[model samples]
Target: MKGASSEGRFVIDLPDSDAALALAGVGNQTLHSIEALTGASLVIRGLELVVAGLPTQLEKAVGVLELIRPLWQEGQIISSVDLQAAFKAFDKGYKEDHASLSDHILVRSKRGIHLRPKTIRQKAYIKAMETHDLTFGIGPAGTGKTFLAAVLAVRMLMERKVERLVLTRPAVEAGERLGFLPGDLQQKVDPYLRPLYDSFHTLLGMEKTNALLEKGVIEVAPLAYMRGRTLENSFVILDEAQNTTSAQMKMFLTRLGERSRMVVTGDITQIDLPGGVLSGLVEACDVLEKTDGIAISRLTAEDVVRHSIVQKVVDAYARKDS
Candidate 1:
């Protein structure tokens, strides 16, 4: 089964030279990845491609290629996300599921880049947030937990589904003491909330985001500011919940007023809480998992859409920890 027979050779006629180039990627790296994945040889000449391998390998190679056909067929460069997601789709359902994953666009930036779910669990996570009043997305870094939540929250605000958008995160220091910083309270904590600010800047253009911030349509604050307030008719996102204590998380949850939606996202594995301190996010998952009208999505490394290396890094650390 390892050697190719004459019958094992299958030639595919590409639409044109552009299709061939797009499918093969720059320097044929994508083709090489496909070969590595399916144990088949893909040779593209002009507008023809020769796929040679065992019969089963040929079938698998062809099936895998079909999952990414929609992008290549449109002359779009197949990215690592596309290739990786295609491989995942191949292992799970097939071409139909791949199409569905690519079609669930959350928001398009001013650059025309479609912000969409890059994995099936991401799709489910987005769905959970949309359908539920309170949603929790617990996952590893680079899984788009907070980015996707910001996207939906902004979309809802624009559509008047929510009166305002409030983004808060625990300003807990990972290694350094927050009090040692040389500034007022806001200045000291702004660094901790920069990631949340960047997400909004990318979602809405810089000028609009600043204007909204000035008008209080968008508010970014440290979690400590929400202690005694009721956030009504707002979309509230509590990021970095892993740094919150049980008391802090309880206060934050109770602040969710009527006609509001809340999305809590954090990487429990990356908890920076002091030793002996329990993460509120961890405890809340146990407490509210069975509560009515709440949805919790736990995404693994499989859902990481960052550079493929990030997934490897996550898995490597996980192995060491285990």
Candidate 2:
């Protein structure tokens, strides 16, 4: 390793070529990403990275690189998600050493792909899930609300914390009628539940997921199916909850039986309820805002971890709505 320093610039030498390559990404794409994110001029020569910028920008850039170093050492494939998360953490003065922010492993896919929260709000959401029997994750699209809930529910089932995983959502369509559709109740609701199935498939693989569904270890159904039963010893997730009416929401919440956990996630702004009908999610948040054993995590556009343009799009719509 080598070192060089000046008034406003520094050089970090990476002795291991593989680690350096991992950090720089293929074709220097990661380096360019870091440069763009931190507004720092970064040049890679051999295994050394020379960073030059305003003193504060350079310091933050180096902080991000240092934060990611351990992930690379542990053979974790760094992605743009990692970069964005690191940048957001530093920019917001969030304590970067939190385990959920970097090293917490939520679940491992059947193929060994590790999934974890990619933002601070996501970390908070996961922590809430662990601590509270009921948690509400309200956020915009791409904030990982439904996805994380599904992952945690699956993990709880595998760990024996829960006997079953029940996933449900309202079958409301976005200004579309379901009366003209054919087939039985399952067929009518399967389309609305496809997102939950996709999450299950990603984490458990298609064959295993189908097997679990067949055995009833995993159940995906419309919210209407929850009417008359107490969900006991189960990890239940209500997705697209904003589409639920007040009565429906109350019914769902009261269905939580002993030794059960419920995670309700929805985007309030995207509610598809009939005109003048208040969303159950909105009403529940208002009523439960201060209740014990209930956690509410509000994620904003800044927590949107999809493509970069998604944050911009959310911001644009938010501005327009305002």
- Per-model TM-score on C-alpha atoms: 0.85, 0.89
Residue-level lDDT of model 1, residues 134-241, one tens digit each, is 999999999999999999998898789998999999978833677788888878888989999999989898899999999999999999899999999999999999
TM-score of model number 2: 0.89
For model 2, state the Cα shift of residue 236 in Å. Answer: 0.1
Task: Report the Cα lDDT for candidate 1.
Answer: 0.87
Show model 2 residue runs off by greater than 4 Å.
7-18, 39-57, 95-100, 174-176
Which ranges of candidate 1 are over 4 A from the true structure? Answer: 1-32, 39-54, 73-77, 92-96, 174-176
lDDT of each: 0.87, 0.86
The clash count for each model shown is: 0, 0
- Per-residue lDDT over 1-322 for candidate 2, one digit per residue giving the tens place of the 0 to 100 score: 2343566787887767776777778887888999999888888788677888888878888878877766655545678878887877777777454334557888887766578788777888999999999999999998899999999999998899999999999987823466667878788778999999999999999999999999999999999999999999999999999999999999999999999999999999998888999999999999999999999999999888778788889999999999
Give the best candidate by TM-score. Answer: 2
